[model samples]
Target: MQGKKFGTFAGVFTPSILTILGVIMYMRLGWVVGNAGLIGAIMIIVLAHVIAISTGLSVSSVATDKKIGAGGVYYILSRSMGIPIGGSIGIALYIGTALSIALYLIGFAESFNGYFGFGLTINDIRLTGTIALLTLTCLALISTSVAIKAQFFILAAIIISIVAIFFGNSNFQPETIQLFSSVDAVPLEVVFAIFFPAVTGFTAGIAMSGDLKDPKESIPKGTLLAIGTGLIIYIGVAVFLAFNVSSEVLRTDYNILMKIALFAPAVLAGIWGATLSSALGGILGGPRILQAMSIDNVTPKIFRKGRGKNNEPVNALFLVFVIAEAGILVGELDVIARVVSMFYLTAYGFINISYFLESWANPDFQPSFKIKSWIGLLGFMACFAVMFKLDMLAMLGAFAIIAGLYIWLQRKEVRLQSNDVWQSVWENVVNKGLKKIDANIDENLNWNPNIILFSGESKHQSYLLELGKTVSGRTGIVTNFKLILDKKNNKPLKKVDQIVRDDTFAELGIFARQVKVDNIYNGITNIATTYGFSGVEPNTIMMGWPKGLENSTEYSKMTETLLHLDYNLLYLDFDRKKKFGKYQTVDFWWRETDSKNAEMMLNIARFIIASPNWNKTKIRVLFVNNNNVNQEIISSKIRELVEDLRVLVDIEIINNAVEQKPFYTIIEEYSEKTDLTVVGIPNYKIEKQAEFVLKTNHLFETIGSTLLVKAANNFNVLDLDFIEIK
Candidate 1:
């Protein structure tokens, strides 16, 4: 196996075929037939085979398209999807594969004990299983090549057993062979689930990909042939059992085939051989998955440690031993079967989806052995529905664990330097979206605050991204940019992409962008003007409050440049001392003279309320009327603003009766206690730049967390209220 490259037969055909005609076939098939009758059992077998074939076809297509490495399915997935998704699937596949050891060892012990033990206890059976596990683990650890050679004997045993089943005679007369056995039977889906693990062994050969001489050719050829051969054997055996064996015996005896065989000893040997071989397949396959993941930097580095000239994964093999023993501890064959089925079904579903998405999204996904993409889609849908039908909670738990692993991988800094179909998938989606938006550019549409912020460093400025997210809520988009000043970027493009990825706060959906720009203003201008196309363009720009007039001139000029670009501006003067304190009260400063600014300010507050963190927050429409001028009119105007805003908010007017002080003084005295305050920036104040900076800075100098908004339009909110209804 080390120096010589095995071809289709020894490499793929033997392992796959032997494993397919394995534990499930020997131990569980009779029980399945008894519960589901002849026709229903055939349907289950056929359905399971269909999924297996679809998945095999998918693996074949992808294998043909790329030069897969040691990880087999893990390698294919990591290359097709990102490492996170692939790693998650790989972990689950490894567990399922390792647990197959338990499933088979239990089956083996059951058959071995029943034949040899003159009425052995269940504990005795478990002990037999443990001994088998220990022996197999030692064999696998010593030499995988020797393990491959040993399968020859196992295959012969399986062949003899299969012959015995067909040629044997049983004295026990079976009841009428009903197409549909309607007597107290379990659900078809449950039987299907139990039987599905049988056909899932088709991937056994695939896991031996690294040792194959021509994986592209052998994989598809060997795998498809194995599936076809297994289907034939399963159908033949099911039909023969329906005719030759008693329904009562089939229902009661787990090893009914042994009783009705041409030679009971041959059938028993076949059961033992099949179970051992399948367990060995898992022992060989599961560790390699861990080795692959370890190599990919997802798992612990020690699992990648190999021994001998062939580079066997010694550490990973031992890890599989532990996991397998854990699975065996459950002791119930049916329970083990159900759990293994869920894991494999999830893997099969993802395999189908990976193929479907890759073929459709990418033109380079042309394989020599190309099949219909819809087959993969159909397989995915079928697996998904079947898993839920079998056991919704189990399926959900499996998926949840996968998701948990995915998230954990996502948070890790192990960036895989490989291309995935996701980029193409997103490109296809964006292309269609841009076309639609282009077609409807002239039509009036609802506004979404797609904001871009010049956040300095992601590690330090999470609060900025947080505020920006609140500004947009779930309906809007936020791109947090960190500009690295470098006229001539001496770093490689790959390193730059990595840097950007490192800077990104991807969990919040706001992937941070770190760009090397010669000039800050020019970079920002280019990004702002051309960052996005059609409706996704940044309509709003946000900046953190400048500290003590440092770079105030640059900040002011940048603000003016962007403001003139017709972009709505928000300057968050975040109070780190009181970070969104209490989320109790938010004050919206309302003024008729600067009504447009007021609308934007009010909307920002409303969007903040929409955030789960601030959903319970109450809004106050604060009207600053310090002079004793039109007190009643001011109250009515504030109420009208609330009505026009259409958001439920309390109105607070600070007239002469309430606070006999200047407007600026009154803001500090009354509004300083509010949680989040939205203040309007008027046009005239902005015209006088220095005064505007001084006054605005002075305004929020004593306030808590705050938003300073300047709307792009001179539109009246009072009038837009009527237009909103019409």
Candidate 2:
């Protein structure tokens, strides 16, 4: 279902009625008490209009490019400057909303007391405030349609009251004209104080920008209309009060509007009706800002979720209500007005600054109504001028809140940018490089053994048995087995695999364990790279050498590629033994070469020695000598490096002169007892020897285990996962 947009007239009327009727009465009461002259009143009204116009322009400009969410000001600002700035604005907006809520509750309580003619205690006011807040919250939660409907109804009441107030003042005598001429009679401070409330409703208009269907057209028009309407009403009411009610009576009574309303029987109803309508607007508008802020990620996302039916930020609304009700419990009407005024002034000043900077920063973003940048500059100056009138604590508190928000946004932006930079580098360089290398090395092999089994159909079951045997003693491996099925073709195999899982567990019986199975549609390489990055490093990989296919070029290439992977690639050859004995003998074939190459050999040997499975085995080091004069020197150097091994190390220095296929002779001698053979080559390239090693195929067909290491002069063993002799 689509949401209803704010109509043109409503867009203007809501803010207009909210601004004038909401707090103008309270402002006037303060002014009457302060005795601010005509000039002070005029200054306040002019300053307010300037502020209204500036805010309207800035807000409308933002609204034109983006959808205004419930997080009103914060959302618009955040969209303009990005999240960090948006967050600061959001927090400030929330604080302002909270303060406004509190102020309204205070006003509600004071007005209730004045009308009821009772000596209501703070607790009584608090109770009524809580009930009123809860009612508003309930209304907010119902639906946006309902809320807007309520807004329209309240605005109607406000308009009716304003009209009545204007009509009631038609009987103004000559004394009223004389009162206007006696401008010096009222003190300048009092008039300024009274006029401040007249401007309070401007923000209420600004807050409605999010809901307006055509904020660009409606917001500026509505804001100006609201301001104009508010001005007329405030001036009319103020003049009527000044003439009808005596200065002494108005001075002593803060509810001078209510008293003057009594003079004309119908005017009292309008005054009370306006008060209620204003309170309703305050309650309705404040939560939307909070919700918008949350949606922008400036606040918790939970608050942004809002109610499904209402599309309202119920959590934010409820929070506002609670805070406002609490403020009502502790504050009087004066404190509420002061705190609210202080917050609005500070926020409004920033609004002007934001607009000014935005205008200067992006001159292309011209508004429909372009006040000279100096107007905003002067508007901010005027805001600060009136801000000094606030108490020291209120001023400090307001600035402190804004300062905290700025610091928070700065920190947030730094972290956000740092994360973005890191992600870009990883994606553009690290991930890209690894993927390219992987693609070149083995496009067919699935390095990841976590999900997809690496071997073809004939070897799958045997490989599974080998995996089960390998992890027999390890408890941690029980739940880690993953069986990946090809989604496109393995529907039957998936069911069979599930059965295999059950049968395997049944066979294990008491050792019955858990295994994970995933059905995937992609090829092996994609699966491998995906899991490799996902942190699933398989301990052992098992596969089968195809019968009568071992000598095939394809088989050789596959074996060579698998060897390069550096994992324990156990080939389930039918000719090989299926099980291991208690003690195993391993052969370590070392060649005398440069000190650096020798170190690489030693590091590989040490890695084997540290292995839990291989450390207990006896290791034989066969140092082949091609009658090089420096053979002893190289042997001695290797001996020095291998001195720390606890296992028995046998070093055989075979003379190169008597060699009849050196690798063949060595393997024939050691193949009977050796479980594994590790060989090392000379660091420097020997062209004749290299060709012989590559073409002869002398040791290539050997049945026993063999590893041919092509040593480089400056090799770091730690960097190479596996050495490939290609």
Candidate 2 structure quality by residue, lDDT tens digits, 1-726: 646677657754564565466645643543443253334444555655666566655555545544455555655555555565556656666666666666665556666666677547777777776776777667766765675576676666555655555444323232432233244455555556556666666556556666667766776677667767766765656655555555555545565443333243344444444555555566667777777766555667776666563475677777777666666667665665565667777766666665655555553455665566665566667677777764667777767766788788677653222121123333556555666755565323322223223434343354334333432332212222233454454333333443343565445321222223243212322333333442234333344333454344544444444335433333333224522333266566654343333443454455455556655877676666554435466456446556743324766566563453565566666554455555554332232433444432445354344444443323333221111211
lDDT of 1 by residue, 1-726 (tens): 355566888888888998899877877898888889999899889888888989999989999998877888888888898898889999999988988788888878877776676346767767888899999989988788888899999899889988988898877667688576666877777777778778888888888887788999999999999999999999999999888876677777887788778887888788788889989988888888899899999999999988876677899999999988877776775655666678888888888899999898987898999999998899899889888888887888888889999999999956677679899999988888878877776422334788888877634388878778887878788888778888886762455483455433676678577777777877787777777776466788888766565346665666667877888888888777887788888888765455677667666766877888789988887776544446566666556665665667877756554545655566687778888888777775344777766766787778887787878763344432211221
- For candidate 2, report its TM-score: 0.52
**Global lDDT of each candidate:** 0.80, 0.53
- TM-score for each model: 0.79, 0.52
- For each candidate, C-alpha RMSD in Å? 5.6, 15.6
Scored by lDDT, the top model is 1
Q: Weakest 10 consecutive residues, lDDT, candidate 1?
A: 717-726
